[model samples]
Target: MPDYSLLARQLKALLDTRDWLTNSAQTSAFLMQEIPDLNWAGFYLQRSSEQLTLGPFQGKPACNPIPFSKGVCGAAARTRQTQRIDDVHAVADHIACDSASESELVVPILDTNGALWGVLDLDSPRKARFSEADQAGIEALVEIFCQASDLD
Candidate 1:
């Protein structure tokens, strides 16, 4: 595992602003650059109660307007929980934005009041790419991100 402590500090430095738009872009880039085996790193904003719109990302083109009833991202958002899937292909509702992606980790982005802001999604071409430690670390990083931004 990469030094999440170090990465946290680095992300703190990189944010440099309270704007969610700017910070989201930077966070996506930071994760893609720092984490290994990642094919996609990005955000999916909860545009409505029913679906998510694509946000800043570093990877190939992605699927848009993901509903709360479908895919790993949807599961995370719907349950307000982190989702770590070992094999995305096994998921019947898995949205194949990138056929190369075999694994996924999604963390729900909620405010201090527990309002649904969005979700941070990471995709890897390798199966079982995200471990327990990775989920904890990335969740921590997402917490940091929410703290440093004005998500309202």
Candidate 2:
């Protein structure tokens, strides 16, 4: 397990600007660089109530406009909860943006007003790449991101 505490501090320091767009891009790059086994790291912003448009990301081209009713990202947006799937192939509604991805983690990004701002998504090529500890750690990192950015 990576030391999340150290990562948190590093992220806090890395976020020198409060701009959401820049921060989101930096955050995505930071996650991809710091985390192991990750093929994709990015954000899906909630432009409409029922859909998420692609945001800053690192990796291959990704699917755009994920609805709130489909896929793991959709599930997280609809439920306002983190969705950690051990195997994407097992999901009946999994969206195969990257055929090489075997596991995924999506954390709902809620603004301070409790409104859905977006979601932070991470994908790995290894099956069961994300553990519960990883979920908690990433969630904590997302929290830091929320606090540091101007998501309103």
Please name the candidate that would achieve the greatest lDDT relative to the true structure.
Answer: 2
Candidate 1: pairs in clash: none
Best by TM-score: 2
C-alpha RMSD values across all candidates: 0.7, 0.5
Per residue, candidate 1 scores C-alpha lDDT tens digits across 1-152 of 88999999999999999999999999999999999999999999998886999999999999999999999999999999999999999999999999999999999998768889999999999999999999999999998899999999
Question: Which ten-residue region of model 2 has the weakest summed lDDT?
Answer: 14-23
What is the per-residue lDDT of model 2 for residues 1-152, given as tens digits with 9 covering 90 to 100?
A: 78999999999999989899999999999999999999999999999879999999999999999999999999999999999999999999999999999999999999989999999999999999999999999999999999999999
Task: Assess each prediction's global lDDT (C-alpha) against the native.
Answer: 0.96, 0.97
Task: Quote the lDDT for 23 in model 1.
Answer: 98
Error of 2 at 123 (Å): 0.3
Kindly give the number of clashing pairs for every candidate: 0, 0
